[model samples]
Target chain A: MTMYNQTTDERVDKALANSFLRQATRRATDRLRNNKYKASAELGNWEEWRAAGEAIRKNVISNLDYYLNQLIEQMEKRGVHVHLAKTPADAVTVVRNIVSEHNAKNVLKSKSMISEEIHLNHALEEDGIDVVETDLGEYIIQIAGEPPSHIIVPAMHKTRQQVADLFEPIAGHALSSDTPTLTRFVRTQMREKFLRGDIGITGCNFAVASTGSIVMVTNEGNGRMVSTLPRVQITLMGMERIVPSFRELDILLNLLARSATGQRFSSYTTILTPPKNTADPDGPEEYHLVILDHNRSEILGDKLFRSSLNCIRCGACFNVCPVYRQLGGHAYGSVYSGPIGSVITPLLEKDWKKWGHLPYFSSLCGACSEACPVRIPLHDLLVKLRMRKTQSGHTPQVERQIFKAYRYFFTREKTLRRALRLGAHLQRPFVRNQRITGGPPPLSNWTNSRTLPMVAPKPFMQLWADLKNKR
Target chain B: MSNTSDFISNLAAKLGRPTPTQPPPQVKLSVPQYQLSSSAERVSVFLQNWQALGGKGAIVRSEDETLQCLKQWFGEQPITWFKENSKALLAWDKLPTIAESAFSSLNWPLTRYSQSAFDPRDRYSIAASAELGITGSDWGISLSGTVVVKSDPLRGRAISLLPPRHLSFIESTKIQDNLFNVLEEVAALGSPPAAIEMISGPSRTSDIEMDLSIGVHGPIEVYVIVIDH
Candidate 1:
């Protein structure tokens, strides 16, 4: 699989060049956006529901330790083994230890962002364990050896024809772009893997503190198969993913479905408690929950940024983001992408230089904040990250000098007017039809794709002054 | 650490958040009431909505009709059947024809005690690889076309989820007007049972390449038998 921790620029360039990826993303996002509109409108009191969901998430995060302890106690009572990991390494070690004890060779995974966060698939594959992602989107991306471009729709960037072409060689059959034919082929191929899998790995959506149940909402049945058929089941969850009770769960579910797919509810909402009794025929014999802190605890402690942990991974912010609309999730380079990713990735990783550019990718339109179901101030967080970056002296020297000059010019109206007049005269060489078509190295990147309006001939302030004098 | 009060106090102090003053107000939970025009009309409206959501439903008047429906459905598809150990099911004597391995007579009270007893996937297919699951629903919501089943020792959650096709036998008397009405009824039962599942239709998703795939996560085909006994 492609490493998302690096190669943000390369992926973004590739995604931009691939016409099919851009078209498919636009089409799918449009449909999802429409569905969300219809579903949320139908529900009535959607804002109220969003508020309740936000409040519940905020409350849970503030008292996360208490909830975690309560969840562990309740889960243990239900015969589930719970392990808490302070970091990604700790989480991997805990999972590796379990796999070693079980001697598991084959593992089936449901789509989980946390697993993606720690690069669990590579870790398992390195150990010679065959880990198969059972969700169709994850499966397609898994086979192609790429990280998910979109959280909800992992392979949204790929077209059906591309998927057919990809699967044809692997399945040793002529595959078609037809939906039913492709699905049937995948179902047949995955059936064997499901039945034979020694361990089922999944991501936890919400860990119910009251019942100690791991709540998973899926549109596909692979989660059920993975959880049931395998003797051992492992769930990796971010520490912040907890809800107080099922009652609160109802409110969140309503908001999540509407925000994610515009459905009243997902096709399947599975809550698996421990295998109830030996006499009970189905469910995993052993259930293991790996709760990974992996930077969330620190995020939880930060008063200004603590609200970021309240994100439910719905990808609603990504959908409505103007910058994300032009450039997909791959551009963000982190496992968590889009506006939330900008806030999350830098905080999660120690390598600041690699992920530091991510926060600046946004235009800070506040669309992400408006779209955020949990009411996270994503745009504000982006600005804060920029401030932090600047304060830490991470900004490039040339850019810093340019911005310092801009500050001086903007502070004085005379200097600003003179600078604007000088810029208009200097643009004479590049101006074509009153638009700057070419410029110096850095400015060329902006002018090549888009026309830079010629410093607005006469400046708005000058025009207003002329109008006042004429009156 | 050994003392429960000390554990609570220390834990509360560590988080630096105030402990609840009086044990967090007993969550004031209430199920909103929705009124329907009439029972018969409600059932019709429910059936329409169910059919609109791509689900199939049929009304059976008697036990004989129920058996006939089951036999016809099984005759069409490869299936293995398991019967609940309830007196009502036993009176029908539907067990003799199926192979001993195919049909097991479960203990009724024990099955009822455990929420997962009726789970359909537990029994290996008796006649053929089981593709269709058969069960009796505890209640039905006509407005939402939802079937509400309480998980008990006798009833398995898998019975509803595992198979590609699910056939539920629910009574007409149990059909409620709306989801709210069903929630109210459930609340009246006191301290909601261990599990209460509201299944609408076959499991589905449009996640894979944005193509709608039925039975992706849950049963693809769900059939509801509304019996008037």
Candidate 2:
């Protein structure tokens, strides 16, 4: 399956139970969380930094149209080609045209969610062009032929042994499960692709409107290698990913690294201005920036949800999300998954039938909102999306009927009290030793993995009324 | 290719929002000011603290001492020395005569540089990658023992990133009382040229199966040269 699309909840449940995935995800996330804590503590004024980051993002998104125009003007002035794609299809077509024009047979890609959003890899491969993912996590998923399971740690679901098994036949070496050995093998294998690839594609972490430059932050120098080694460099950025100036980038970078992985800084933050002058020998001769609106421009002007565009893709929401912790990213069935995904996917894809159920996946705990670096009120947005979905008639008929019956019973107090008393008595067979271990057909899904709490013998309100009468 | 206006119109239609006639509003929030502690002991405390944060540092009295330290730290190993073509570096005593074969300048564009310089197989023991990776520190944050490297052509974002070992030279006077102080300094500099990166230690990640891997994506080794002169 492509990286953007995901399997259903049942498939995700099976994946999450896999002892290997649970161990790896838990370990990696724990360490990342700890390091982030320490790093932020060290910074001393992390809250101020976060506030500054949020303010800067809020400013840019508010004036996105103007900055985008300014960015286009600057890029064009520098002789860098800029393309604006309104849809994922439009984005794919633009990239395909560039690849076809360059006769690109092998395309080396840096990790870009925009490319994933457009399914550019599948598009390129369909045209018989070999698209190789060079990021270590992306590389692992590409080989397994699965979409990324997490935003920051794409291959968070895979074990090292699994990676070793996948690479052994390809490398013709007895690669070990040891981190160093496996990483070393991938490095050797990817180096050849970097040197010979026809095009280098990357995602823009932030685009500087003032200079027409795209900023990419990475720990691996692959971003640098990919953007620099190839004859052509193409960057795909969401339209809302613009910042007015570099000074603003400083604040964002502090928050981005700290919130995403809890590092003082990513090892490398590369900013490529239009190709260097003729006197310079080391950059792509052809530079292209694809500004994708896919659905971001709409999110920008939205009153309740425009703040969603302020996301830096730090994956902080996913890391802290309780539902994501249980179901993993695959269940969300979108390139952007977890709290951010629930809000964004529906907005991006107008087809609510496919994505409408996603917003309900959250428990409305507000943990995602707290974890968000740019301070996007992700939980509120998820609830709003759910409301929108219902208003748009995307709710299933069965669910609507169930809620309708509940609404009728709950509006009248006498009916509600009688129903509760009857529910306690009727649930006796299903309830054993104070908890419902097994239930009727409709409630079976709840009891399948979770036990339902035993209903009290008497309603609390009724008990309170009896006590008052005795007094 | 579709015209730019068509793309913008299509985007507006998809988002179901009114087409913005002008740009969105720019909100200018007052950035908080950061003041450095004016204590004589703060500098030494900062240095000691920085060392505790996995950073290596030393005080050199003269050029001779600098060369001696270099020899002691890395001797006879094939090394890539990145020194500026500046007069100060040129005037160093007992400077090693790096043959044309030994050194490569950062003159190559980023792509060519990666191919020629990076060898995962250990073909080269060291790469004196650039003449120098000059960075004007956005003030060193004493509280965290971190230094911010704002991106510029002279700093060459890659200098701090690509090498297996990174050496950054900063003046002694630039170290500040805390991270907030640095933010104020950055704000005062107005808009930085392009990018500003706060580097604490060597490139590190615990990503692969929770194993702490140094240099997974950036330099494995990091050195900070604090020049008192």
Candidate 3:
């Protein structure tokens, strides 16, 4: 389906060339990282909280079917309509049918990565339904007709002037290129949409399985507005977004808010259970919860990538990923982007070879793993994906044989010493400025994005060999 | 819609197992660590944390004090207020005049929300025109310093969200130490409202150049009145 607009390297090149995006990413991530440091420090036992968060996520994912069903039963008991979608097509059809049934023309959505993955907006648009994004960031990107670059901050790449430029046409007048003016413009513009919207679609942050409540944490009040003002509220949740109780939520949310925006708490954290009771004056009368699998079952059973589902979509990993910081989210070429994206995108797609190259995009810095709130070992997952790719015969014959020969010699110290001696002479022609920028066929590929260090005149093994002999 | 079994069976087949008919055992986790000595201490912490979150708060001992605090914090700003009409506590002479409210949507006592759900098409302009929203909180959390608001006919969600300012009144007795405490309390009183919101501060955004902008879609200024009496 040509998911990635460009190859990874080409996309990285484009991101690197845009000095503006570089500065913006640097500033935003640094600000968030600093805020995270301060907020976490205030917790006094941040590591303990992190470990606790990881444990809860692990427990829930292990018995996902049980918890998901429990959540469904609880919601049903409360008169909530729960739908299970095994595929993207099933999910889209369910939502489309509901829209058609309600005769809903206008649909307002808050920030939802799953919605982006399923291409919900396009599906609704094809049905000729008028859809509007209510989140300030999503609203801007929707109008621009671009997918969100970052999960938390969709319009992170757009400048104030750029944002104003996008809004100026809608406002039909010149607008100031400042934060307040741009935000005020969006506030006024989206208010009418919220009041006129027939259906509100929101992403579930954490669904309390025991209580039957779907939770959403947002900085702007859009989440509250979208869920409250509309009559029919449709919540699109990834099946794995379930937690056992609010107790787990306390620890996870602390890390999520602190790590995402450095806030002690988000401005609004809403827990909506079901259809409004008779006494409840104003809320969505029709509540629909769609639990989407979308091939997540494949990852659930797989031991290597199961932990990837623990992600709360806080975008904390994206902020810390050195690769993501350099290349940006668009470079990942998936609905989900950054470290979590690399791990899940390949598993979700049927064509491993096409989407499989994503795992190799990482430099294995492990910053994302370290920054992860639930402690998903992203770098380790990447390495495992590479091994799987090679084991599946995706690696070319020449490259496989070369690696086999290298492994053979590397296992024996005698062969390694002899090979180092031979390689020192062979590399003489290629060594430039004491770095191997160019060499024979196989080694040249390694130098494409990096410079290989020149072989020392005397190998470290040899220098240490004399000392060992004396001892 | 597919039944739970079919989805579970499909997943089990992929996982190489059968769906368990028995419910999984519930695992007990540690309760959150927020130990406050008394209600007064909690409300004190709530006020501090609320201010730290960029919202304004005042702890008062009487109705007159609430009026004084309201005037001192949000003076002359038009606001729509929500309360139990069955037992009204605060007097109206001090209340600001709001141009419109959620109650203005075809009169109160919706009888059955499902039968006559809020139709956005009919009342698109009422919520957007307010400067502030005033409502009494169901409960308050001290550790997070948040006021929990339950959405009902009296207080629609838009009152706190649409306006640029929010004036929330919290009873000193309704304060809890942590989020779990509040949830446990809500559980004690069975049958949760359709929607419950734990609002910590005024609505804010950091989308543009990583700059903090308050009152983007909801109120920018939030003033909490802690009724100690």
Q: Give candidate 3's fnat, 2 decimals.
A: 0.65
What DockQ does predicted model 3 obtain? 0.46
TM-scores, all candidates, are 0.84, 0.83, 0.90
The interface root-mean-square deviation of each model, in the order shown, is 5.0, 5.2, 2.8
Better of 2 and 3 by TM-score: 3
Ranking by TM-score: 3, 1, 2
C-alpha lDDT of candidate 2 relative to the true structure: 0.69
> Which model scores highest in DockQ?
3
Q: Can you give the lDDT of residue A255 in candidate 3?
A: 77
Q: Is 1 or 2 the stronger prediction by TM-score?
A: 1
Which lDDT tens digits does candidate 2 get at residues B121-189? Answer: 221111223322223354566555666665332223444544456555555677886554565565466
Predicted complex 2: DockQ? 0.22
- Model 1 iRMSD vs. native: 5.0
Q: Could you arrange the candidates by lDDT from highest to lowest?
A: 3, 1, 2
Question: In lDDT terms, which candidate is top?
Answer: 3
Which residue ranges in model 2 land beyond 4 Å of their true spot?
A2-7, A413-424, A434-437, A451-471, B6-61, B78-203
Grade the docking of candidate 1: acceptable
